[model samples]
Target chain A: MQIFFSPFSPYVRKCLVTAHELGLSDRVQLLPSNANPVTRDQDIIAKNPLGKVPTFITDDGVVLYDSRVICEYLNEMGNGSLLPSGGAARWDALTLQALADGILDGALLARYEDVARPEALRWPEWRAAQLDKAQTSLAHLQAHPALLAPGRVDIGTLTVACALWYLDLRFPDFGWRERFAAVAAWYESFSQRPSLQASWALPPA
Target chain B: MQIFFSPFSPYVRKCLVTAHELGLSDRVQLLPSNANPVTRDQDIIAKNPLGKVPTFITDDGVVLYDSRVICEYLNEMGNGSLLPSGGAARWDALTLQALADGILDGALLARYEDVARPEALRWPEWRAAQLDKAQTSLAHLQAHPALLAPGRVDIGTLTVACALWYLDLRFPDFGWRERFAAVAAWYESFSQRPSLQASWALPPA
Candidate 1:
């Protein structure tokens, strides 16, 4: 399998972290692509018309994009180890993953609005609104930090960790750590793991 | 099951349409809620920290939010009637849903930027950027209308309809019909269905 990746994307990082966690890192090869929201790569557009990164082409030529779906497929291929086995636990984990992914989405858009638009065209209100959503989601996660337990190291925890790491990379001034102490501590501990440590190398600013 | 909803939410409309199509509409009651994103609603926030509408409180009292996840749960309850059974088809359906949902997200944020922010604070460039994403996604769907059919009425088709409906509701000036004739035709026909008609009532302006 080959994974189309953008180094600066937290979504791609989540997939990579999942790959490492499931011990399937070597089963897939990563192909770098410069598919931005505005300037989409033709090849990436062909594979994923949405022009988003972390599009995974399977060994048999099956194509999957959207980090959540791809990570779920990878988890299933790895025998459901990264996802909880059944019932409410499974839904909770999936919901948490979705929430974390939502945080990343807001943060990415906030950052994009900052850099992608001209200075006079920048909307502080819009950026603050996105940040508000991110902060609220982060607070929720912090309140439920136990959800990030070792036993609960499902896709949810992995993606949440990745989302925070990206914040550190792009919006270090967001003050997420001071506000979300529990989640911050949880991510700090999780960051030390080999999978995260290896993937910690920052992409270009 | 009780679904907390507002008449105007595309997300809520998606769930309502899914329930009606799956013959589960009668099983899910719609409760009124005023959960505006700008003004936080504690009651709704208790159910979904994100405070988004279309939060489904199951008979078992488990709350599910986010239209995509709620639709998946509804599909599961009806014996996998809406979603594709498995394999590439399933991923394709999901990816399409994600794409359509992406359109909604962009459109919604643009609308919110226009309405909720002061004119001086509103950024036309940022709004244009989001509009561009919505337009691109719509064009892609237009070019690949086959993905809308030749299978069960999956989440993809459902969301594409929702996205078009949203565009019609929010951006009548976008003139998507001129550029994406096929998609506009598809939505026009799809919107005529009884299920869709029932869910088609516009939100408050």
Candidate 2:
């Protein structure tokens, strides 16, 4: 198995963390990629028209993409219980994953606004609105503490961990910890898992 | 079941279309929303912190969201076969959905640049690069004709159809039909399905 890798992409990190959790990280080789929104990468585009990182290739030569699909494929391959099979557990986990991904989506857009778009054309309201998604999401988690209960790890929590990882990486001074103490407390503990702590890099060419 | 509705959100449309396909549209109520990227909607933010359309509430009071999860939930609720159970078929269907969703993402970004953002703050290069995603994706589909095989109306094909629908609605002059005749031809035939043809609107209050 192989996955196109970009060290900073939260989506790529989500997949790698998922692979690590399932003990399939050793089987999934990382292929360096340059996936960008404005200066799109043709190399990655050749395999995934979206030109996004974390595009996966199975041992049977099948291609899969977008972190959600790749993570589920890894789960199935490893026979892991990261994703519940059915019922409310499945919906709740999937929805939590969506919320986390939504936070990352907003964070990435804000990051792009801050760095990718030219300064003269940047929109402050847009950037703030993007980060507001993370703010609102963290507030939601803080209010509904059961959603992030201690020691509960699954796609939902893992994806949230990845979202928080990106938040800290990009918005160092966003200060979510001060406002969402419960979420901060949950993350402080949950992020210690080996999978969340693990990092990946491309092998020497 | 109820879903937050935005007349023009392709994600919302995807869920409605999925419900229509499963003969569950009648059971799903549409709740009006003004979901926007810049001015977030508090009503939607109350249930879904992401403040996005297609946020769904199940009869059991469970909330589900983002089009992918809602579509899958609708499929399971209606016992539809939009998503395969497992195997390569599932991955392929999902990856195709991801590709179509990616196209929509780029298109939405371009749309926001055109209308949502102020003209003085717009970056032509940013908009062009966003649309380029759709161009490259169409080229990929044109190259791999089998991916959009005739009469195969799973989630993948349905999503690609929705992407095409959005392109026609928003970028009428995108000229995808002229550039990728095979994709255009396939869409012409496939879109005649009742699911794609059905139009959704909030019931008179």
Candidate 3:
């Protein structure tokens, strides 16, 4: 198994963390990628038209993409219980995953506005609105402590941890920990998981 | 079930279309929304935090957001086969859905660039790059005809149809029909499904 990878991509990290949790990280090799919104990468685009990182190739030569799809495939392949099989448990976990991904999406857009778009064309309101997604989401998680209960390990929790990881990495001064202390505390403990701590980079050519 | 809706949001349309396919459209009520990237909707944020259209509430009082999770929930509720149980079929359908969603994401970004951003803040290169995602994806579909094979009614094909629908609605002069004849030809027939043809709107107060 292989995944098109970018060291700083939160989506790529989600897949890697998922693999690590499922005990399949050793089997999945990292293939470097230059996925960008404006300056698209043709190499990754050849496999995934989106030209996004974390696109995966199975041992049987099947291609899979987008972090959500890749994570599910890894779960199934490893026979992991990261995703619930059915019922409300399934929906809850999936919805939590969606929320976390939404936060990352907002954060990424804000990051792009700051760095990718030219300064003269940057929109402050757009950037602030994008960051507001994270703010609102953190408040939601802070108020609902059960959503991030201790020792709860699933795609939902893992994804939330990944979102925080990205927040710390990119928006270090966003000060979420001050306003959403419960969520901050949850991340303090939850992010200590070995899977979340594990890092990936492409092997030497 | 109910969904926070915007008439022109393709993600919202994807869920409605999925519900329509599963014969659950009648059961799902549409709630009007002013979901915008710059001006976030507080009502949606109350439930979803993402402040995006297509936030859903089930009969059991469970809330779900983002089209992927809601569509899957509706599928399970209706016992529909839009998503496969497992295996290659499941991955293929999912990846296809991801591709189509990626196209929509790019298209939406481009749309926002055109209308949401101030004229002085617009970046032509960024908008073109966003639209290019659709172009490359269409070329990919044209090459892989089986991905859009006839008689396919799964989420993947349905989403591709939705993407095409949006392209026609928003970028009428894109000329995809002339450029990627195979994809255009496939969509011409596949989109005629009653599910795709159905339109949705908020219920009268």
Best by lDDT: 2
lDDT: which is higher, 1 or 3? 3
Q: Clashes in each model (backbone N, CA, C under 3 Å)?
A: 1, 0, 0
Q: Candidate 2 lDDT, tens digit per residue, B21-89?
A: 999989998899999999999999999999999799999888999899999999999998899999878
Indicate the worst ten consecutive residues by lDDT in candidate 1 chain B. Answer: B196-205
lDDT of 3 at B166: 92
Residue-level lDDT of model 3, residues A1-205, one tens digit each, is: 9999899999999999999999999999888888888999999999998888879999998889899999999999999999999988888899999999999999999999999999999999999999999999999998898899888899999999999999999999999999999998888888888998887877799
Candidate 1 lDDT tens digits, A24-113: 888878776887655556687667666678889888887787887788788877876676765687677777787777778778878977
CAPRI quality band, candidate 2: high
For each candidate, the DockQ is 0.40, 0.93, 0.92
lDDT of 3 at B146: 88
Where model 1 places Cα greater than 4 Å from the true spot, the runs are A37-43, A200-205, B35-37, B200-205
